[model samples]
Target: MDNGKIKHIGVFTSGGDSPGMNAALYGTVKVAEQHGIRVSGILKGYEGMIDGHFIPLESQQLQKTVHRGGTVLKTARSERFMAVDGRQLAFKSLQDNDIDAVVAIGGDGTFKGLIAFSEISKIPFIGIPGTIDNDLAGTDFTLGFDSAINTAIESIDKIKDTAESHNRVFIVEVMGRDSGYIAIHSGLGVGADAILIPESGEDFLQLLKKVKDYRSEDGFIVVVSEGDELGAELVASKIKELNPEVDLRITKLGHVQRGGNPSAFDRMLGIRLGAASVNALMNGERNVMAGILDNQLKFTPFDSVVKQHQLNEELYGLLKTLNT
Candidate 1:
């Protein structure tokens, strides 16, 4: 609760790795330096925190990382960190290193872990929404969502080329385990014929009818989020059964969407949110996530941010209208 009690800040990325995470780390380091606060890089997220994997980071260590993807400090999912004993160990590690606070970058799972850790330790914690899913409740857009959508769009564009050449229906699957943000945005961006998301349960018959309607067209593209009711495989199977004579292919754009240089928007968002996280901690904010909502930076309680994000119905309707 005392701002002066925080002299050294620890930062780490956990859960799924995403683009622009390094930019966030860089921004945190640079801003902490400006504020004369020491920065310690916690390698491999909470696992590192438990093992006391501490490294002093300067502004020089963050050189040229803005354009880079992934985290310079690395990331991991720690089952051990979930236990009370493990959290105690993590707190001891922080105390041993003289780290008074933390800036964590990752998705909902990361925040959940931070909340658990906070119950056992007094170190203030600030979270940055750094996930491709864009499924965090507090933020309008997460740090890596923009770059991830762009990556999927680029891959969809390439698949469209071959789909057209072969006069085939390509079922393209994108990441977003429980949300449709990536599928909706990339689907609209690539002008897909139909888009299936987890939020709107897949209607196989409806999809079949749409494909049949577009049969005479040059080619067809259906964008499906991996978490959809009918995944790419099942959807493709149903389509094949309905139209055995139709040329159909399935393309799952897996981890590729999580890599590559972050887009301009993501880089800027990461930097801004990263700096905001440090400022929040210095201002005595704890157990909150730093994010941008309505183009303004803000902090939300960790409990609220970790809740399941509702799908944007307006954007879903726009996708339908545009596709139709």
Candidate 2:
């Protein structure tokens, strides 16, 4: 890590907003200010970069921010930023503002934009994992994952009361269009009778068997990830098709899981990684991501970081055995 030419750095959040993003942003601003590196908040992520939406940042701007969810700077996914000209325009704006380095907080799409932008601009970029999906590689837990699982658990717990009262089967759906971290953890936490995730390879038939096995029970819960190849709706349809006499319902937690104050673990992770990103740039590291691997802080090159697998097989197995 030897390229510390950064005098001023711009920070932004992009892609889907996560609960701990503001905590990370606060960490970056505070640490950068202490080191005498001028800081600017790039509004709406890359769109702000292209549009020149920058606001001077100091510790005061971040006061009382650690307890908040989403990002103080806000976030967005930019299609224009995906184009070469869009990136060039963003670079020109950075130059005009005297920004020398950048730190972005978000998930895979966020990193992809940073990687492409860094390729054409001398200004180095670093990424901080900030999504609740916990699907990205290189880190054990993404910033908002713990908070999201807890939110889902709370919602499902209430829904369970209805299921029990009506003596009906409820197939609850949680987020994870590509990954099942939310489903696996929240389902297990609430002690669902069964859980169905895309990666588990537990097909519709397997789920059908679980439903039947638990038929003697008064009521039961089945947790399903949205990305499950079998699809949650199809699972419901099939169940009703075979067990016509069964009373059933479906609840999709939706964006509600994305809200709520970040959990303690997420706050610590966001602040630590946020500070680490600033340190990494000062140490001359670029085109990398700040990650916590095996409880140790590390800087992984963005290319390799995004390619790593994130599923926790050990927990998945425990969910299956214990829930039965």
Candidate 3:
């Protein structure tokens, strides 16, 4: 391969770490190898970009990491990247290293960083959504989301078995900072008596009333997001006030949802997205995200993705009706 014709592609994992990141990296590297291009792994997200923490990513090493959880390339969040000085440093790193393009594996916040980096250096970027939150704007499904929901429901199912045996009222909290995808899906899958999310904005008192009604009729199981406005302790205390004999309890599934080997669905999506990102770069697309649309790979410019896909209304509506 002519050295002058060889392109250097940089890959990084940013924002909240999730499973399947390594798989995406593997796919990108494998596809790039077909074109005689070299790949570099940037550690610790954009902070690594600023500090130049990177290593050569060979196809051999990438193959070893495809089945792994979390990123082989470590991740970090740096507020510095939001500023001019930081962007300058990142651009300087790329120019010095001859990086021709970047494939960013992250959620919304990291995608925003890619947009900023592109604006500063005019470098091409392709994003693969890889967060457990599943809150990324444009994608119908984000990598690690299915795995997370599966992890959460496993816990929920376990809790359900115990709650059923004891005839108890248990509230299991899952992860979802602002989105309800995890809680809603897990609740629906496991037949949760009630599901609470940020979008629902259901009042604590009303929630208590519903729980009380459930207890009166039969035992209850609720799945709530950790970001739910009301804390589990607060809800339990209010329930006690209503009935001193109530056996209401809370189990917060913190970080448990983000762990574990990604299920089959996530691994497949990771492969598809990872390959699609490489195709986007080869096609001269820059500052864009690759996502699955109608079971097909599709590309959307970052600006349009940010504006159009945040907080999907149709899915939210279905979640609401399911709760009812």
Candidate 4:
């Protein structure tokens, strides 16, 4: 697609909300303006795309949004977008608005939606990784991973103080369904006695063994990913059943992990990827995700982006070594 031909661009955040999504909008609106391209902010993702919820954006209005927790345009999952009829409506909306191209801020499901829709439509789409899971393949860091782990770490640290005072074993559950990045990073950051993630393939016995070594510590914290085979409840039950004298408690850090100001790294990453998405479109790139690998911008075609990024075995090893 020629930049001259691409006069209007539509941008939206889909699925889960992340800390840096607003900053991403800032970058897109600002950069697209420089290229003489009009940006239409689509509300509520694919839902808005089908309903024709288009709003013109200006850089000046987005100045203070860089540090915001959630997205300015908002985000949501659309069951309708999964159907052929729903996508047709979305396509008609774009055509009606004369949108030349689009940028999507979201994770696996979002990109997959673009690919599926493309089979029946002609509009080009470029994506920016925005999920907290950090599970997208190719990107070294998704938009909110840093802020999420930082949030998890801060919450875990405070929980430690309480656990230490009561001489209790606290089993904390964090998000990242089927992925361990959040649990691993937060657990390691807070010096958790044990970290249980789905990738570890570790059973409760193995986890108990790790905790045994640090049992005498003032506060015992075990970070378990929601995806872990033995979740916080099971772990708590097993531990309490095995040792009746041990005081144990369970805490599920739910949506709290998904909210907060974008961390320094996340702010930079979000804005950088956002700007890169517009640049990619201007350079005639589409059906790909704007990502950072080795601290440099890279694009992975939707066909190449996998469901899950491989956890760095080396980082996992480091997590184990450092905790010991």
Q: Compute the lDDT of residue 231 as modeled in candidate 1.
A: 92
- So what's the TM-score on candidate 2? 0.95
Per-residue lDDT over 161-213 for candidate 1, one digit per residue giving the tens place of the 0 to 100 score: 99998899999999999988999999989988889888875345567877764
Q: TM-scores for all candidates?
A: 0.96, 0.95, 0.92, 0.96
For each candidate in the order shown, give its overall lDDT on alpha carbons: 0.88, 0.86, 0.81, 0.88
Ranking by lDDT: 1, 4, 2, 3
Question: Which residue pairs show collisions in model 3?
Answer: 44-74
How displaced is residue 41 in candidate 3, in Å?
0.3
lDDT of 4 by residue, 1-324 (tens): 236768999999998999999989999989988888999999999999999999999988986899899999988899999999999999999999999899999988999999998899878899999999999987899999999999999999999999999888999999988789999899889988778888876445566665554456487888889988878898888777666667788999999999989999999898899899998888888788999999989999887775655778887787566545
Clashing pairs in 1: none
Query: What pairs collide in candidate 2?
Result: 3-284
Per-residue lDDT tens digits of candidate 2, residues 64-104? 88888888898888999999999999999999999999998
Better of 1 and 4 by TM-score: 1
lDDT of 1: 0.88
Best by TM-score: 1
Error of 2 at 17 (Å): 0.6
